[model samples]
Target chain A: MTAREEILSRIRGALGDTPSRPDVPRTHRQQGVHRPGTPELVRQLIDRLEDYRATVVRVAAEDDDAIGQAIADALTVRGIGQVVAPPGVPRAWTGRLADVVVDEASIDARTLDRIPAVVTGSVVAIAETGTIVLDGATVCGRRAITLVPDTHVCVVRAMHVVQTVPEGLQRVDPRRALTFVSGPSATSDIELDRVEGVHGPRTLIVVVAG
Target chain B: MSTFLGMPGVPVRGPAADTAVGHLTGDRPFPAAARDSLADTQLRRNLAHATSTIRAKRAAVVTEVPDWEALRDAGSAIKADTMARLPELLEQLEANVVARGGTVHWARDAAEANRIVTDLVRATGADEVVKVKSMATQEIGLNEALEAVGVTAHETDLAELIVQLGHDRPSHILVPAIHRGRAEIREIFALEMPGVDPSLTDEPAVLAAAARTHLRQVFLRARVAVSGANFGVAETGTLTVVESEGNGRMCLTLPETLITVMGIEKVVPSWRDLEVFLQLLPRSSTGERMNPYTSTWTGVTPGDGPQEFHLVLLDNGRTRALADDLGRTALHCIRCSACLNVCPVYERTGGHAYGSTYPGPIGAILTPLLTGLTGGDDPNDSLPYASTLCGACYDVCPVKINIPEILVQLRAEHTEAHADRHRLPTAEAAAMKAVAWSMADPARFARAGRAAALARHGIRRGKPLLPLPPPLNGWTASRDAPRPSAESFRDWWARTRGPSS
Candidate 1:
């Protein structure tokens, strides 16, 4: 047998027979926000996120032209010129921003090195914690898009927001890659001083599209 | 064969072995030298600032949820249940992992765990391995083990890299380099990083970029990776790792052979159990609504991730810890580090003063329990006295470990076991003994209180006279002696106002 098999056999032997079942329920109590709907949840999530020092914006959900224009306007206001987007990102979101270079997913790291911001969608949003969960799924793009860029603009639809962490975990299947971001990547390691945007995105901008 | 050239010497026993002996002899305690550490004002200020900020943030976010209490309870219960049935769940976990094409290795202690990981790396013919921030590895001293075998363990986490470069021990659980500021980090980077820019500043971005540049090469080059899990789900046979840095993702994916060393107690009964912990861990630890990076992998996929996966399930002293009914609840710790943030003693002395990977209130109770204070050096006996019995650790504990109660209990045990060797002559203990003897008769009890009042005139203007001394010096060392009143409160009250007046 292979090393994996041998290791497994040892584990099996060490563990022995299965024990009696616990009386407690396996699933946690669902304590999600009782939002009237997805839009309210998204707005609430945005408000809570903003409280954490995250920059938030509101945009149209279906108007790719407006979405692109808004992103371009935001980037221009921030004095950024280049942006990176995953391959599956809707072209409509980029159509209006001609001056902003839209680096494609297949672009090499050298080219991506020039980009200042990346816009994508989130897999889920947790209202209770004001957190956004993203995988390399639609909108949220690949993990690198959110990680490598200096600024991350994650778009969350009102419909995708959940009430609590448990609800969020249920929506995320472990088989696929997942990244759960609360605020921007931060550290307090330095003399217990909080310094934001250390290794991941220095700034996380949430675009809550209703 | 080339890997053996720069190797460090491997002791016959691993770090766990030393700890086990320490545990067995009941000898490893806080040393007298550590007493001075509690007076470090700079460390106190740093810890005060760090812990307060995280505590406030945690309280704010935690209160946002209506059922957060329920979640905390559930999380504690799940962990308790898992630990109670650890032997069986471990077997189930192994079977499920094997069925899913994953491998599991059982380590009786740290030495066994380290050997398994080192041998696994050797089998893969990898000279170097990238590492994620794993407390288990630190607990078992895996890096030292790997080094002895000529395997270079490169820490991928930014803070961990700083610790590795500085040759310093981790000072905080969540932030290993918490004791270091940006200036210190920059200095370490300049001195240790190969081809690092000379103009590096203490600016956050500059330091992070330097670290990124340094690690990017290692990430691209390493063929083997090792990690520890935050949570191990038995039902799904999965391991979960959470971090703010993307390095964990890089290390988890980039390596060809992945080895994870997890404490056996890390297991939860099922994936669904994640709900309660997912809520409790992030907020309690970093004061974030959610962790920035959470990665979960169950076995191997054909072409997607590491082709060979090995999970070393380590017991170390967990079973021994489990046998003690009152102490076993410690296993419920998700390592969220909430208790450390609120512990007054820890805030002043910092993590290094504990002399163990586990520190603060949790370490105070845990280290002695795991090591079982039977024999060994003076430090082990001293650990029980390390606490101020402030009860702050219990309040902030997400799992509600009742740290102060446990500390007192351990102190009693320490005193009882080592009664003849080092007897404490505490004034309060002597007073209590007298009171206990008098309390057997109501007449003697009444006379004792009256006599105590008559002796009150001897009390000095400001300084109170404590009846006994020496071992009680631990308390009086820093505090002003509380003066006894001119008359006992009970007698004064009775003389001034009749019982039913």
Candidate 2:
């Protein structure tokens, strides 16, 4: 017999008169927050993002120019002269930045390594865990765009923020590779101290644009 | 290029366990190994700092959820239900993986898993592969096996990189190099990591920066990658890896091919069950609300991540452990490492003393059960006695595995199993039997009690003779023995109530 058969048969033998499984009591709270329609949820999102050391700027205006200015200011402060922005993002945002490297072709890892930053729009942001989920859509690009660069400046519309993981997951397209990022790349591997910037993004700036 | 790992199919059962989990022997027994570890003041300080910090963080996040207990119950129940239907779920997983453009291999033991991975790398003709820190790979000693075939596996996770560079075995599950301080890490990197920054400092960010620069180059160059799954959804053939660093992302994405070796118990019934584990794991392991990255991929995506994926389902000793209801709870472990952090005994001894790839509270009972404790000299038989029956492990266990209860049960099994191997009565058995027989009769108990009172005459200056004799000397070797009371409690009560009652 093959290993698969042997393994399965041993498992079956061990479970002699396999009793019916008890019903799962999934009574755990699934919502991200207790109170619905509270402004605290959005505040909680910013609070958590800041706690994890991600730069959060809320842009209340719906104007593309206003969102563009906010994105420019974040880049100027950090001296990031170049960035890779995928298609489908408002051109006004990338148009304002210096040396904006928007290529029509897919970016390779070596090229991505040379780029200083990446600008993309996320599918949803979870407030409870301070996570940003990218669905690799036209706006999100592929996983490599967000991952291979030193900085990730994600644009999250106010409407895109959800109160909990379950709420954020509802908007996820499971077919696409899903990268749920809580903050800039970090490691507590050395004595459990939180050290940011390890291989992914060193700086994660979120423009909470409307 | 070499098939030094044996024939590249299924491994036979002889020493099958040696393949599944790593080595079965520590250089010495727990006490002997722990003595050396405890004496290292620097290691103690490192462990104390790290475990306490993580412990506080776990407690803080765990308290945030009002339904934490319910979540724990749900997590435990889901794993239990998965185990009951594991064989069926595995078959379903295989079918789904094949349907979704992924190949699945089954390994009965560790040697086969290693062989399968070695061949896959050779098939791609990649001499070096990048790696995500995975307990399953560590358990099977995959890197060493790969090296025997002339393949170099570059560990990308910061902690794993530290262990790999230092040429050290892991001292903790989550933080593999937890025993080393910052200065030691800098020293390791300076000596081992090629092209490391010459001015590396002990400050964590500087050290992390140095590692990042070194490993990012490796990540970009490697053609193959290997990993272990946090959870595999059988319904969709989706594999999830939760990590704090993006190294896992690099390994999972940048490589041309990805091979993941997962234990059969890692399969969940459905994707929705992630609500429970994803919630429980980060809080329990790192004390974070959520880790930085949680990457999920189903089989292969055409223009994305790795186009070729292989899932090796491993079952070295899981089937044996699952055979017993009492023992199988150990298998429910999610590799969270929470039990190790809070265990008082583990706090002192560190991971190496347990003599298995898995160590700490879980390893104490798990090692013996997996090996079946077939002989008196089994190295793991010494493990079950390593614990102090402190229920701290169970109290903090997210899955609510009753570790203390299992420790006690295994201790009984070990003593019973080892009895026949002894030609002469062992001291422990003789002592227990004497105590049991003496307590069985009231008259004999009184006689024994009077004799104990008479033993007080042997005391001088309120202390027993320094080197008494045989059994008495064993008790006095480490501690001063207390003098017996002139009057036994039974004697005091009996004189007054003897005739009246």
| Steric overlap count per candidate | 17, 2
DockQ of each: 0.25, 0.51
lDDT of each: 0.71, 0.84
Q: Whose lDDT is greatest here?
A: 2
Worst 10 residues of 1 chain B by lDDT: B1-10
Candidate number achieving the greatest DockQ relative to the actual structure: 2
Clashes of 2: 2
Candidate 2 collision pairs: A32-A164, B19-B110
lDDT of 1 by residue, B1-501 (tens): 011111222211111234742122222345544555657666666667777777787788777666666676677677767855665677778887787788888776677788889999999999899999988898888888889999999987888889999998887788887766677788999999888998888886677777777877676667899999988888878788988767777677656788998987788888778777777888888877777667777777554457788998876666545555566677778888888888777777777777777777888877766666642255656677788898877776777787888788888877666654546544555767877999899668767777766665645653446543565555555665555555755667778897634
Question: What TM-score against the true chain A does chain A of each candidate get?
Answer: 0.82, 0.91
**Interface CA root-mean-square deviation for model 1:** 9.2
DockQ of 1: 0.25
